[model samples]
Target: MAKTDKQIAQEVLDAVGGRDNIASIAHCATRLRIMVHDKEKVNQTEVEDIEKVKGAFYNSGQYQIIFGTGTVNKIYDAITGLGVEGKSNEEVKSEGKKQGNAFQRAIRIFGDVFVPIIPVLVATGLFMGLRGVLMNEQILAWMGMTPKDISPNFILFTQVLTDTAFAFLPALVAWSAFKVFGGSPILGIVLGLMLVNPALPNAYAVGNGSAEALKFFGFIPVVGYQGSVLPAFFVGLIGAKFEKALRKRIPDAIDLIVTPFVTLLVMITLGLFAIGPVFHSLETVILTGTKWVLDLPYGIAGLLIGFFQQIIVVTGVHHIFNFMEIQLLEEFKYNEFNPIISAAMTAQGAATVAVGLKTRNKKLKALALPSAFSAFLGITEPAIFGVNLRYFKPFVCGLIGGAVGGFLASLFHLKASGMAITVLPGTLLFIKDIGQLPIYLLVLAVSFAVGFILTWFFGYSDKMAEELKRAK
Candidate 1:
């Protein structure tokens, strides 16, 4: 029999040499991330040898103990003890500053750079999507109205909030990257300002069109690097390294002044000339390759997206698609590909809702209902953790339904005419351009039906049914 969460927690605490050995603890997805004062005190071999422990790491001056899903919080609670160290400590402390292996460092850096900015991005992205839905000509036409009649100020207010973050994204990335690299954040802000400076010639567009624009310093191309990612990350890394090197080499009296100047010059040069082009080229290659691959049999792309969307969301890599959406919006003035993702989101929500309605266990049903609602609102974490993943069959059902919906939408070339409002039934507003909104609705209906039917049929395995009945 599997150990109870409380038993696992206590055992994990014991393996790590008790609560005193730990400085702090946090959880992400399926791991108990812990900070320790002394790595040697924790028995690494023994911890890994434990039945539930997947791995352990000692890096960035912290020891991390990995556990599978459903066990991290219990272990964290046991380690921290009751009524003393609440969950908020996880947010107050810097988990990324701790040490581990190379992969751990990479994961820490990624989380540090992106996690803080997600809520802002999601809120802004969703707002912009909603504006598009409200403003689309077809949507207004269907409602017996016109865009010209809408108040200009109201439109501008919405547009400003939606576009501000994107327009100034390089600054955000630079700030976050600086934090990731352990550098002075002000320097990152300066670098970000230079990227979006209006005076800089647009190197990105120069070769394709204009030939008369003057170059920066007559050698380096003055590319408008707004929203650039790799440039800031690479530059921040170089800056941190240079600062550290300067501190060690210079006399103590002159260290501060010299270190800052030397690091600034080196980092700026590296960012503008080397990192900028390399990142641009890499992004180009990846986008081209993805487009080519996705152009293959439609079913293949649909299958891939359906199966991995939730997994990607869990790992926080879904921002990659958010990046793609921004790129498409900049280049094409709108996006059509996002609707496929919307279909998958809807399917997941439908499955969770079905499970909530069908399950007899009150606790499970309570968990599933809230998760379903969150998923419908374009927040899938609750659903992934609480409903779909708990009963694996629901997740599978959702994936199959999503794939079918995606294929049909692609077959009819049913692009997202505009962004959805809240990823709920409100997204149906974008279907006005399909010329047959009812057909689009029919596809979503079928997807929901599939999820509901499949969950009802296959979700209640013998073991689960027995456990659920007992719980009830």
Candidate 2:
């Protein structure tokens, strides 16, 4: 017999300690994101036992119950029907401000704003990687063709596929930020377009000295904000507030006309002179700071991130890295962090497998093994939430394994030409320098071996499986 979504929803509410514990609620692609007033009141193990639930984890002050994609929407609706109010991602986020320090809350807001937009970036990155593969010297040479041998139409097709998103990325960011900040999304998009308007000097061109910035009012310098995230986001936020404020004052008959017009006029001015350059400078500083860390001695930077990246993933805040990776791919044309991050991820999957093999409990084995396979395929949430995080020692073992792999990757100067994908799918990113394929494989193998061996020897136990047993 198939269980109804309403039944599942009821189970979920009960498992999370009823409506009293829930301060605010929302849903993402695969998880029921809950901000609860009392974490201690929830029965986490029981929640994981639900047939439809894939995994569960606490991250960034939210109790995230994973139900995989597609199924989550039904469950979300079921809960909403049960009379528990569902909040927008931003509204729920506002409720979470009390959970962490200002810095943590800022990071959470960044993740919330950007997570919904990652699929587009991922699609763009995959195409970018594929284009690289098509143009690889080895691939072309093997096909008995030189670079010039490629058809012009095919080249144009690839360019159109890979380049368009990055060219208009600010608009996407602006639209998303507006939605998050409770503004009119379309108007925010218009503001973004205005920043990249053709009349202003193109940002990339101005950077190379091929175009000049125009003078606003013959005093303030104005340049296009193409590829600038902070400016678009900040401007979109202001525009939303401005429009809302205007809506309050204007007469109903003329409100729609006056509000958008005034908001756009004021925002375009502020975006060009006040917000754009300042935030653009901040973006530069942020990227430069990250690059400086990446350049540090003997792969120490890799060591740190490779070990703890999964910890971040567990919190579900890993989407914040999507923006950074996209920025790297667009500006630098390669992703330096991919190899290290992949190593960490592969290690997590490996650790899960080790626990699966070592566990005497049948249910634990069933969950751990499949989660391990998913992790190997470059999806680590199943492994992290369902298996490794459940057994604390396995998570630590994975961390140690990733540090070693990441160190090796950084030491060898290995990098991915793509940004989003990793592991087996990530291999495409190395086709340009196919000789590095073996080294990349070696990184994965080493991570897997270390994680597997350590976990098999010392990771899982009766105590760890105790809760899982109840869930089952």
Candidate 3:
């Protein structure tokens, strides 16, 4: 019989030295963020040796243990149950002093807020890409060849599946922000829903939109907070601080009712008057800056997209780029400059494929093959954490290879006719008016060749050989 999720999580917790060793804990789609008092206390090698564990990394004082799908929450619960004492209230207070300036804090906050939702975004993105294949080819249309050929039911289903995540993104952000700020996530979600509620008048709405629009004391204006990033983030931050303050002042008697009432009143006022406009301005500035940056030298954009793409995937911040892509697609109707993204995706897949082909370790090779295939299918985390990153040389080779490919694509002005990465195999979609297929192919070829050769040449290390021997 398969071990229950809790059982596996408990085993992992015990292997990592129980709850007492952990200083903090969080999770993403496929990894558990374990901050321990002493990193050495967590037997990372032993943790990786576990069947459920995929890989481990020590970065920014966090011991990240990667797992397969559906395992992170289980592992998180078990880790929490281990009676590990989180940093005390005092420790948290002192830690705030160590944080950098506003700009750095903002960047850190953005990373924290965006990284956790990547897996679901990728899964949904892949589904959206595949849906295009089904719909565009007349597969559904053929089934009903009536006057209105396209099946409304199929259209509706696909539309909902593809757009639901984007439409309700604010709520998701609110949940993440709440957790990050150490507030009641459920309450944050409720507040987020209220902000996004379609029935309510959106202050951001230009004309007479709704009479019951969100207002501060029935006067101050507030925008529709759905699909927004900054507003919910600020609200969540204030909400957490308010929760902490209320906890301190309110006595045990009627503390729940009194504290909640006070926090809600303060948070709503602040959200409407202060947090909303500040975040709105910030969002506008970011969007403007991104536009300016992208309009610079094509080579610079290419280099950035190529280098940062893989790094973003490793850190799980690639979804931020995905969000940008969606906004671009919606605004422009087609993404002309996204070939760089395609090249990066191809590079990651190619590197992992190379690892599978070249590695001597049977178990490592086993991990590599499936992960490479997944990367090729546009799911890169498995490949990134499982294969390419494990072999440092291949990862570097892939980055350089991707940059070269991106530069070539830019040089030839190759453009993607659609917003999907699935256009890779169908090179016809990438052919621009300038007859750039040859250059495009050459770039892709070089990227693949470089990745393969680098992996084969540098992969057969002593540790890997030993691992292979042990597996045998």
Candidate 4:
């Protein structure tokens, strides 16, 4: 019998020890993120067995249940209606921080600040990709025109699509960071704008020796923080703190005017003079170190990163990669991390496919196939928690597949034009260069084949399915 939404929600609540035990409830993309008061009262196995529950696992101090996209919202609504209050994602994250250690909390913060900023970047990347296609020499030749024949105004229009986001990227980052840190987001945007004010020397121009930095007090070199992440992030963080501190002391009558004025002035000064210079350098150093590690000889770096990336996901710290990806795009105009991680994602999905093909249990097979499809679209929690992680061996096999795929990625020097999107949708990132699409497809194919083959032969059998069923 098909279970109604209410039934599913109630079962989920019951499975996790009911309304009283849930300290907080939220949903993110594909999972029901719940913080329960007592882990001892929750039944992990039963939760996985619930209708529409793809899988369940404890991560970052929250019991996350996979329900896929679209469906998660319905379930979340049903759960919230049943006499249990629903917390916003940020509020739930706050509750979760009380339980997670330092590293987990930091990763969660990274996700909170950066995830909202990704859509604009993805759209810009797609625009860049499409522009690349339109401007391709071969494509232009087919249209009986040379590159020089294209209108200057049209070229400028393309630049508007491609360059605007990164040009004002600090504003976006600062706005999001301020909101995350509990400050006035508008103030953060204003502060971020000050960092890239036209009066200051452009960062790219300074890098290229076309322009010089302005001398502040004859020694401090002040330049516009164009395409910079850390400066904007710290400015937002400190600005939020400063604003909150001012709010406590300011009188209610003039609080609104006084708080914003003081916050913007102090933050802009610190951002351009103190925080901007220091953190930009730090961001550069970090990016340089990351590139060095990723550029290790003979794809060894790829092998290590690919094999262990999923394990990091299991620990719920993988959002830390957002910083690396963002920095890579800012520094090099290309993201090497995207393709490597895409390969890792592909391998996990392939492993799930193998499980679906091999499992004789109807219920398990039903769960595995759709989860694998979801993984190909670049959501891996379903495949990982529902299928790959169940047998352990398949998970390891997927890691091996990912390592090989990543090794090939490095050897081929695979790079994506953007971040956020991966696997099937990630193909759009490779469309800029003529041969890149084929190579990217080849990498995914190899990852899938290796993952599927290995898991099929050695990672699973009918016996394990029988055992899992008996245990249930």
Candidate 5:
């Protein structure tokens, strides 16, 4: 018999120590996020066994249960209907931040600030890919047109589509960071504009020696922080604190004018002359180190990253890669990290599919199949937590497949035109070059085969599947 949403909600609440134990509740794309007042009172095993619940785990001081997208929304509503007040996602996130340790909090900050900006980059990436298709020599030749035939105005229009987000990325990062840090977002935006003002030498130009940086105090290098991430983030963080401090001191009568005026003046000075140079240099070193890793011989770099990428995801520190990918795109205008991680995700999904095929239990099959499909679409939490990790061996098999796919990706020097999406949808990122799509398909195919084959033969058995069903 199918469980109603209200029934599932009641069971979940009961499993987690009733209404009093829950401090707040929220829902993300796939999970029911709950901040509980008493962790010891909740029965983790029972929660996992609840009908319609895929899996459960505690992360960043919140008890999260995988309910799979739309299902979670229904469950959250039901939970709220049971006399427990529901909080907004932001409020639950704030509670989580307060409960988490320093490192967890920091990672959460990175996610909070960068997540809002991904859509623009994703749209830009798609635009870049579409433009590549439109301007491809082979395609153009077939159309009886040459590169010279394209008008300058059209090229400029393409630049607007493909380059606008990246050229002014610092502003977006700063604006987001300010919101996350509880400062006035407009002030952050203004300060970020100053970082990339036309008067300063462009960072990319300075990097290529096409333009020299202005010498401030005969030592400080002044350049436009175009496409930079860390500098803008730090400036936003500092600017918000500065603005907040000023708000406390300034009287209400003149506060509006004085606060923004002073905040902008001080932040822009620090951002360009101090914060920008320091963080930008640090960002360069990080980028250099990342490049060095990718450049390791015989695809060792890919092997290590591919093998451990999902492991990092399990630990919840994978958000760090967002900034890394951002930096990679900024420095090289290419994202090598995307293909590697995509292979890892594809492998995990494949392992889940294998599990579904091997399982005789209808319940396990029901969870495993959909979870595997989701993994193919680039969301792996359902596969990772709901199926593969539960079996243990399938997860390891997926890691092995990822390591192989990652090695091939590195060997062929496969790079994506963007970040944020991977696996099936990730194909859009490789559309920039005609040769890139085949290599990407090859990576996915090999990853899927290895993951599926290994998990079928060695990683799972009918006995294990029955055990999982019984345990549930």
Candidate 6:
């Protein structure tokens, strides 16, 4: 008999060593992220055997189980029905800080702050992609118009649709950061607004030499924090702590009035005069360092990341790279990270495709085909867990394919205008530079071909399925 979602959730919970062993639970777009009190108590083999569970793995101190998109929500709801409390990302971050070392905690916090903000950015990115498509000379000529003849109102509308969020990105970041740090989110928005006030020149303009620094207190430098990340984050942290500290001394009667007043007064000054400049420089240094590494000669750095990327995905911490991708878009206006990572994903998908075609095991074939499709659509957990990682050899083969693709990508100087979307849909990114699109196709083709051929040649055998009992 087929198991219901409740039973699947129950089985998952049981396979995770019961509700008592679970520290916290949450779900993302495709997986259940469970923080466990004891990793050793969890039976991975049993979890993999459970009905409706596609795959499972441990990474960033969380036990992640794949149920696949729409279904994961049902199972998550079922788990909640069983009296297990599902925590928010903030709660998960708080618990993660307690359980993780410094680096792990940092990664958790970064994910926490940015993940919530991504939906808006993605919507905006899609609009930007649309605008890119509309601006294409070929597209324009096909539409029987030229750039000079295009409607100004349409351009203005696209500008607002595509650019407004990124222009005032610090506000969104500050709002999210304050929530992550345990503060009133409304107050965080208020502070974020001040950081990007119209009175101050915009950060983007400052970069183009259209805006100059305004000195405060006769010596301290101040500029708008528009589109910046570090400044708002730092201010939100200090502001949250300041607001909490103020609430302690002020009497309850007048606390609301006085606390916000004092907190904003002190924190805004700190942000403008001290915190903003310092952290902006730090953000620059970090961005510079990343650029330096990613740009290494002969695509050496790209080769390394491509080879190990899927290995990192198995650990479930691969989502953290989105932050790096977004930072690339914000700082450099182009993402070099996506091409290399997409190469890795395409290779994984290719390996799964080869396995599906070569395997006589009907069960493995059923899993491999859809997972490969998902990987091609920029989701890889299914491919990595449902097929590649289990066989081990195929995953390594995929890495080799990815390394070759990344080298070719680097050699061709591939770039993307946005992040968060990849593979087939990522073709939208190269719309403005149609010449680069074919080069990207070449990278994907090479990656896919290498992974498919390698996996078909050595990744599996008919006897192996019987040995592993994966045969239907």
Top TM-score: which candidate number?
5
**lDDT tens digits, residues 1-472, model 3?**
8676677777777777877776667776677766666656777556766666766775434566777568776766665665654443335423432344554445556656666765555455555555655555354456654435567897888788766665566667677787877887876776667666776555335324434445666776666664566777778778887887788888989887887777777876677677876886686676666656565675777766766777866653344664455444433333434667667766777777777766676667777777767765556666776666765666777787677767766656565444445325535344322245566667677666665666567643546656753764
Q: Please report, in order, the local distance difference test score of every candidate based on alpha carbons.
A: 0.63, 0.83, 0.63, 0.90, 0.89, 0.83
Each prediction's TM-score versus the true structure: 0.69, 0.85, 0.61, 0.94, 0.95, 0.87
Question: lDDT score, residue 422, model 4?
Answer: 97
**Model 5 per-residue lDDT tens digits across residues 187-274:** 7888788889999999889989999999988999899999999999999999998899999999999998999999998999888888
Better of 3 and 6 by TM-score: 6
Candidate 6: worst-modelled 10 consecutive residues by lDDT: 463-472
TM-score ranking of the models: 5, 4, 6, 2, 1, 3
Candidate 4 vs candidate 6, TM-score winner = 4
How does model 5 fare in lDDT?
0.89
What's the CA error at residue 330 for candidate 6, in Å?
2.7
Candidate 3 least-lDDT 10 residues: 89-98
Better of 2 and 4 by TM-score: 4
* Candidate 6 TM-score, true structure as reference: 0.87
For candidate 1, give the lDDT of residue 392: 69
Q: What tens-digit string does per-residue lDDT give for candidate 6 at 376-401?
A: 99888788877887777788889999
The alpha-carbon deviation from the true structure for residue 39 of candidate 3, after best TM-score superposition, in angstroms, is 6.2
Q: What shift in Å separates residue 454 of candidate 6 from its native position after superposition?
A: 1.7
lDDT of 4 by residue, 447-472 (tens): 99999999999988879766865886
Name the 10 consecutive residues with the lowest summed lDDT in model 1: 83-92
lDDT of 1 by residue, 2-102 (tens): 76667667777777777777666776765566666666677754575465564465434445565645776666666566322433434424654444456
lDDT of prediction 2: 0.83
